[model samples]
Target: MERFTSGAHEFLIPMVFYSLFCLVLTVNVAGAVSIQDDCHERRCNNHEPPVRFPFRLQDQQPPHCGYPHPGFQLSCSENKQTLLKLPRSMKLLVKRIDYDARWINLYDPSRCLWRQLLDLNLSTFPFVDEIEPAASYTLLNCSSQDEALYKGNRVDCLSTSASQIIAFRSDGYAYLDNLLNCSMIGNISAPISPYFFRFRLKWNKPDCGDCEAQGKGCRLKTNSTEDQTECFYIPKHRISVRERLMIAGIVLGSLILAMIFIAVGWRYYSEKKKKEGLLKIEMFLEDYRAFKPSRYSFADVKRITNHFKDKLGQGGYGTVFKGRLSTDILVAVKVLNNFKGNGEEFINEVGSMGRIHHVNVARLVGFCADGYDRALVYEYLPNESLEKFIFAARGKDRSLSWERLHDIALGVAKGIEYLHQGCEQRILHFDIKPHNILLDHNFTPKISDFGLAKLCSKDQSSISMTTARGTMGYIAPEVLSRNFGNVSYKSDVYSFGMLLLEMVGGRKNIDDTVENTSQVYFPEWAYNCLDKGEELGIRIEDEEQTETAKKLTIVGLWCIQWYPVDRPSMKDVVQMLEGDLHVLTMPPNPFASTDPTKMGATIPRKPVNRELPTIPEIE
Candidate 1:
């Protein structure tokens, strides 16, 4: 019973949401109808109900306003009285038109209504008397002397005509005393009234209120029938019971068909989303349909990493743990931090690195996206990273030789170039520094850490970004200022230049531990040294290393130019690396310092933090 109740509770949640949606829709529809029919509540004058759409007041509405039925129409008189006009030179002073009841009380302007009684056969009108429905009063037009032949109780003398022809009413009774001189004109709409000048009328019009209740617009038909006596909602060519049934069936069938489609679509969407949300994702089973990766469970990841025993490194995104595969092959398992505002890094790695295969780039072996536990698997790099070598302690034997650093730079450049052009989609690695460059057993550099990578079309030259990305020293001038240029592949080039200078300097761009702020901003100091044809303060071992360092410095300066357009492409940088030192000239002052002589000038260390426009996050 508890299980059944729980299952029922789960089902009721969706039902509740759906019911709320439908209720909102229904309320909106009702509100719209109320707004339209609200005019029915409006009075032409303070004392009367408003002239409704089907019966618009002449001056108040357009020509198309009101019903088409001749008898159903009403007009305001010169004296501000509402009047209902009828045929045969007659008009009824409208006392009140009960729109709800579909009943009308009428008054005759002239009290000589009894005289016109014989002439007033209202069979052609759309109304019959509500007081005595279909009741008729028989009248006789005879001389006053002949009135004595009639019984006193059955007859009432109306009035004596100008021609001395007396009119009298023969109430619903067998008055056999009537002479052959009386002509039976027609049936009266109702019984004889004591007042004789006023009566009530019930419209034989179609039920407009009921039609509106069924969500239909109402109008009048000039051509009348039993069902559509005068007014109707879309008057049919033939208003038969069979026709009505067929129409009703068609509407009902269409509604049912629409409901079926909605149900099917909702079910399909729900099932698709459910499959995506499951721990064992069936979605990625097709993510690389032909080239599927080895799937791993959360337990498998934890076991392979030995419960994160051999930690490789940790960053803003996650911690990397060294793991050994079944084939005794080493792998780097980046176990993403679950608490970090939804695991976007996992998606970035899988979405970006999953698609490409290149010699210079890191390979994504597999992934583990088990609900809360998410991790990325990559080919392990044994030599740690270039950062350890770039910023090695003084007299450390571990520093990379200039020849090796140049090759590493070339490899890194190639990786970035491949990311920009070789892939099906252009991948912009927003965060690129020595720390992100991993070296394999062969000392071949492979670019890693795609946490801040963004994919765009290869045809697109530039990308728009909301917030600043990458380390402060390595970020491009264009990235910091739109005035410099648009953030593009050139931005990456600029970062690479900064990395190159840092590699040569053998320290970070901003060394906060240093006392002097001028020497702290390394880019400016490097520029000043290169400008004066002075030897860069690096302990060069040989001429080849010296030549390689000089060529790299010139290229780095060229790449770090303030404008994105001024920077060389990664391919160009690679070509410059392979080219001779004599072929390259000293690039212009990229820092745009007012005085190159002022070596004491301090460079700004902070990246300009600009506010980005609002955008929705893509799951």
Candidate 2:
């Protein structure tokens, strides 16, 4: 009895103690999640906003601040850049993170895109490169270029320096020497041009769109493996597979019919909107009507425009006719063409303009989308566009006063500011040149033309754009190449900066007639002037107007800074323009070329003091 008690009691006592310790540990771990606030917002650098639990900077963040261990960890470099370490020895220098959209833009700091591409192991990492082309080429760093083996195009870099990576189509892949050299195939990427030092990165995360709609911040659902995120205030959406299948079928059938009708009606009239104008868009917009008002019929449009007689102007889309809505009200009826490419122009105007209303923004009074006919009715500005004023014959009497131009700039800034923040949805007018700015009888500038507008949530970090938008001179660097930066409202800000510079110099940014090579790009010229305190010798009406020109030039320089991070927001732009001119300082040059010249630059070479003096006419 004594022996049995000694062995059994000792074993049972120790086991019970161990079990109790395990229970307490599990409970404490669960409590750690339940007891704390959902987000601990942290800003890694000035360029990025406050990041939370899912993304934590290494060494800087406490343990349990972000994900516990391996996943979602980032390291800060000496330059204050956040580094994303991927599996299989790949590193990405993070430029910015859109926490709401869960999109991250990265690049190789060394400016060697080829090295990063060669080391990539896509299967090992969760990131997806959507902005880049789906195609990639294999580069063989050889002792010498063999005439026979060199089937692919030899990348011409900055004269002496050439790209090691050779671009080869699948047809040319067979010509490469596989056995003679160490052939390394790059991963998914853009064309084998000069390295631009940028890549777009995206990660798969739980959908928090609904959660944000419920006004709750997203959090990692504690102790979960898959579908680990949840909105703090709202339950996660879950539906059975059968229900999902049924819903998919219904959406598909509806889309198919709508696409067919829109395709058939392509030859009719309505201006612009190429890709987004697929008839299937009505499904999304119908619910959005709560965000809009009444829709006008094609007959009403014809009647309003007096049978399309009073023509105001004509663009790539269609003709704008000035019409009288009533004796007291005048309207601009823009009639679009039939099918151009897609119907993005029609979709852009009605979808975006109808939802927005501001003193600075042109009011979308009504619209006509009758089959094969689309027309947008807007408040008429008797003074026409800011174009006639800013580009007013250099010295003609029609040229606007400097004070009035200042007011127009401020008004446009406020309008863009409202578009970016005041509304329920942030609208990015990819085209923000002077042409899109209409002046009322009182010279109050109203932003018009939603033909290239994009709607995004106010909190979203970035929005994806499939194709480039806007006129040539006003297009931002990032809009054409993702390597410059992610596309956001900042793209519009860049355009605005160019517009202001044009106002100061009284010339188009890309004008070849300018005698000075540095002045060809108006923004760069303006920067040089302000940087050196050289007075912009424009036709000034009054002595005080010089101060106004200085202020606009300084703000324009700041807005047109090469990187999006260096540019101010529309909100900030308004404040700067409204503030004292003496306090404003010059910004870094916007035309400073970071990468080597690409293969096909047509501009003549001149030794300019600044960088990229002439804008490359990239298609």
Candidate 3:
């Protein structure tokens, strides 16, 4: 019996050895299969919410070893002492993991309570299955009025200190009230198992009907219940692979097309700007070439003008210096003051006068257009402007005879009429006061200073303006109001009328004070004297002087009707000065008194006949 038992033990030992060998082989095979199935191209578990491709773990190690998305890649830290390797920016702490639910409860220390997580794109990672739809919370001191909207559904808050259960469907994570007031919420704390809650998941197919009813397609279930299964309502409008590729191709093509358009537009704009600049330069050169005024360097100008020794007159634009170009040729050199680097007035005067050649208009001999220095050279006139003679209170030596005054008036009228009708473009002399009308040695009037002159085509009766551009009292009423007709050649007529009045008054038309008498406008005072058959206080003592002054005053009054249409043209103005006085009547007072002090003195004057004169046709 002992020999038989020994032999059986020997047989049992061989059987045990063979069974152990088979078991080792089976374990090896299982391990190899797990490695082949789970191991990805690279290891990538340590990213943020989304993990990238080419990184995974062996099947035996667990699916959580990789990220949830394809592009979020992770690399092993050089210091391999840490348990879970992660990026420097990821503020995450894994509190618990449920094996049955295949879910992890994590706390993000960087989370914001009211902020939404949808802005973060989580699809790049692979290991992170999904992000939870709702944030976890606990009801503490929250009042009943406090409500939370979760997954498009509003949930009311219960009483304070009540235990609350908030479950997130996307990651199948459940949160519980450990201590209502002391619960970890938002980015407050990193939770451990003692305060953490986990979920228990069951294998359940997603109910796609609810998603379909809500116009959405079914996604993988993250959380499931006994009766109702969990699902993500994905939109049905997802692009197909081919459509996605086509879209990408279209986007690239569109970008190329946009680039082409941009390039074309830029080239066109650049060329256009270049052409405009070149055109401006050419025009400036052409207009300014012939009359280049001997390129007087600052020193030459100083020498020619004798360092401004012989000043002819002082005016708003600048001072005029009488300089001698040669012993035989004397010139009037006007040196303009700087107007904040705006040489527009200087350019306009030079440009306009250079293009014009008329007996009545002053000729532009030459000009300078240096950086800050501007000068205009003209043939010197022996006599000064009409204002120095006619309007001076004490300068009787310079006073003109009635015949000379008439000739001067006729010459000035012809000049203005020429400006209106003769040139290719009509020139409106905005500053038409006596100061601008100069007299030569023969007492012939020549209109000077085209600085404020505006050039317009003959057919254009009116011009639009942004601002009032003329002497204050001389500006037409129509220029100030839109209710009046378009500002036309009529505007110049109005200025001429004012000028005629000033010529007759031998003083400014608007001046109210005279010696010691109460304030009185020259026009009103003259009209009163004429209507009452009183003397005009003529400085000259002759019957002819009396007749000339009366005729001049009447003609002046006839010209200065308030409305531009009521005033006479320059043609009629000359005729009235030359024609007999008996045919003329008192013109209607256009500028009737507006001041209360003069209201009682106001008297209406009758209008003159409109179509009475036939002066020479303007050529």
Error of 1 at 607 (Å): 17
Q: Pick the candidate with the highest lDDT.
A: 1
In model 1, the worst 10-residue window by lDDT is 610-619
Better of 2 and 3 by lDDT: 2
Candidate 2 residue runs with Cα over 4 Å from true position:
1-293, 338-352, 515-518, 593-619
lDDT of 2 at 270: 36
Encode model 1's per-residue lDDT on 1-619: one tens digit a residue: 4564476567657766665665565565444434333223234467654565355555555534565566756777777777677666566677777555676777888765655555576656677766654545655555555655654522343534421233334444445555466655444453335245777777745556665555445554544453242333442244458545655654565576558558756766776677668834654464467334565888999888888899989988899999987767889998878345565656665866777777788888888888888888888999988887788774468788788989998899889999988887778898889899999988899888887777776666777878887877788876776756577778889889888988888888777565655566676777777788787777798888889888888888888877776788888998998899999988877664534344323333333433323222223
| lDDT, each prediction | 0.70, 0.69, 0.57
lDDT of 3 by residue, 419-509 (tens): 8887777777877778888888787888887656777777655666666767777777666653444565667777766677677667776
**Collision pairs in model 1:** 42-50, 43-49, 43-50, 54-66
Q: Weakest 10 consecutive residues, lDDT, candidate 3?
A: 187-196
Tens digits of lDDT, candidate 2, 1-619: 4564476466557655655655565565445435344445666677754566567777776755565435478887677767777655557677776665666777776676555555343444445566653444555543344533553454333112322445454335665444265354444343322245676666666455566556676766777776477767543445558655655654565566456446534522232344347554874576456436457888888888889898999887778998987899899988877445445556664766676767799888778777778777888999999888767777576788888889999999999999999877778888898888998989899999886677777777577777898898778777787666677788999899889988888877666676656555555555566767786767776769888988888898888765676789998999999899877766755554422222112221322222211121111
TM-score of every model versus the real structure: 0.49, 0.49, 0.47
